[model samples]
Target: MEDALWAQLQNTGLEEHDDKDRIEAESDDEEVDVQEELSVPHEERLQGPQTGPKGVKADHEYHQQKKLVTESKARAEYNARLLAKAPMTTTYLQDEANKDREELLILQAEEEEEDDLKYYREKRLRELKNMSRQQRVFGTLTTITADEYADEIDEEMGDIPVLVHLFDESIPTCKLLDEHLRGLSNKYSLAKFIRVSALQLEFDLVESPAILVYKNGILIANLVRIIDEVSTRFDIDEIEDVLTRHGALSENDLYDLPTNYA
Candidate 1:
């Protein structure tokens, strides 16, 4: 019985070894199938040598270097164009801006000057117009004439000329000269000339029997006593001779003085 049991044990061990061998062979086949399934074709996969951490880092750095070189070239071209355009663009814009400023200032100054001139001219014209309107004509000298002179004279004498009587007709020598005075008055007419009676005009004055010369309602001078009286008298004949010398007197012979001195 002992010998039979020992043989049976040996047979059992042999069976276990065979089963182990079969399991190992099946596992090897399955590993081969999995590797084949996971792998791509030789043409499709990257065919290269085996790589490590250092090789991979080097490949990435090469791509980065190429990208940096391309970007730097593009940036340099753009900066060059920008720098070239700077001087012309800035100078043109600045000149245009300054011209506009100058034009505006000139227009403003001209407007102010025109306004000032207009204001001054208007002020001066207004003052002159007012002064011209508020002036008087007659003066204080109009109050001194006597009653007879008032009756003989008109109020509006206004720039008219007059003649005068020099000698008294009461004297015989003056009476002889009265004919010559009448002849002189006839010779120069339109001289709104007159003769004063010597007795009437000789009051309140040192020289008597004199011819009073008048123009524009003011007494100019008098013709005093003289020898030749008619042709050679140095009289102040303002209405005739003096005004003729100055070219201001007109003599139209239609209006004549009455010979009341005769």
Candidate 2:
């Protein structure tokens, strides 16, 4: 009976050991399951592209990002290639100098164009005034024989310059001067021209051909028949110049001649 009791006690001990082993095995399985639930997946831990806040990778935004990156790279390459042609100096002054030079050339060109336009405008105005002066015409010469015509000469005095030739018809120089005076009368019709024989005036001729210039009712000059300031046979331009210088013709008369007529 003692043997039977010892055998029963051994059996009970074996059963308790078996139960403890089963419980430890089940606890190990539960610990493995808890570890799996707490840890993250390998894909979720990777440093991938930023999706939206809800973790969605949109197709349109991904394509747009790729296009922007490609365009940025292309622009950077193009700028680098262009800048290689003209490299910057240590101070970057060489690039700035070229830019300033280009700007100066553009400004100088604009100023030259403006100056040329102004010169043309002034030239055209002068040309028009000269044309008008040449188109004007004056009247005929008056031959005075008696003092009765002096009143008529006095009336016309101050308005125009009066050029008078006192002549002795017997002198050959006087006859030549009379013809030249008549020609001048037709040209300067604005001025009054007169011829008076000294014999008709009952005066003695100190000189055969005497010219008197009068302006504004006063005598300006008395002269002999001379041209070219020295010789008798002279150019018409010289005659015109002489008349203009002496106040018979105005300053505007000089501009009426062509440039080459001098």
Candidate 3:
């Protein structure tokens, strides 16, 4: 009986060993089959994008737009830490505030300079542009029929030109002279443009349109019928030419020419 029991025990041990070996062999086969079926071909993977949704872009461009947002979040956290009133943060905040103040002052100064330029340009444009018939017909010309109360010509500030046009007749030529003088008033804001009749003049004048230019209370030129000689249809340029030639005025320097008594 003892021998039979021992024989049974030995057979059972042998059977257990065979079972273990079979299981291990089956597991190896399954592992091989899984690897063969689940893997992609190397060539197929090479044909597509390298990795992720990035589509093979440079490392720098990856999450580039989001970098700003993340950086902003980090800055906000840093600012919060600084405002928490630690000693180092207090020093950093004070320095940052001083830097910000300096930047603000620089920006303010630049803006003021820009505003000055803008004002100068606008003023120049208003003086030069859109000078048509209506605008040309009437301007800042001072009219003196006889001897009015008083004019600013006597108290002439600087070497500003005092142009007195003697046009008494109500004829077409006198009217044209009036139009020309009116246009000049707009162009030459620094100079005084005056229109006086024969009744106002001390000297006896025969011609209709006579112009007398004075500077610093001194006589410059007494022009007679020069407009009638220049052209029948006298425009602004011809008159400007005459004035520039006579040294009464030249091209307007806008801001450069000191108001000279403005």
Quantify all predictions' global Cα lDDT against the true fold: 0.52, 0.65, 0.66
How do the residues 1-262 of candidate 3 rate in per-residue lDDT, one tens digit apiece? 9999999999999999999999999999878766754475754443443343335572344356457657888999999887786754457789999899999999999999999998987776555444321232122578875565135456564667777777766545667878887777766755677877765666445555777787767778768666654675577778777877887765541122223212
Candidate 3 to truth, TM: 0.43
Candidate 1, superposed: residue stretches over 4 Å from native: 1-146, 151-159, 201-208, 226-262
Winner by lDDT between candidate 3 and candidate 2: 3
Winner on lDDT between 1 and 3 is 3
lDDT of 2: 0.65
Which segments of model 2 are wrong by more than 4 Å?
1-138, 224-229, 232-239, 251-262
Colliding residue pairs in candidate 3: none
Q: How do the residues 84-113 of candidate 1 rate in per-residue lDDT, one tens digit apiece? A: 998666577789998999999999999999
**Residue 134 error for model 3, in Å?**
30
> After aligning candidate 2 to the native by TM-score, how far in Å is the CA of 87 from where it should be?
65
lDDT of 3 at 37: 40
- Report the C-alpha displacement of residue 143, candidate 2, in angstroms: 1.0
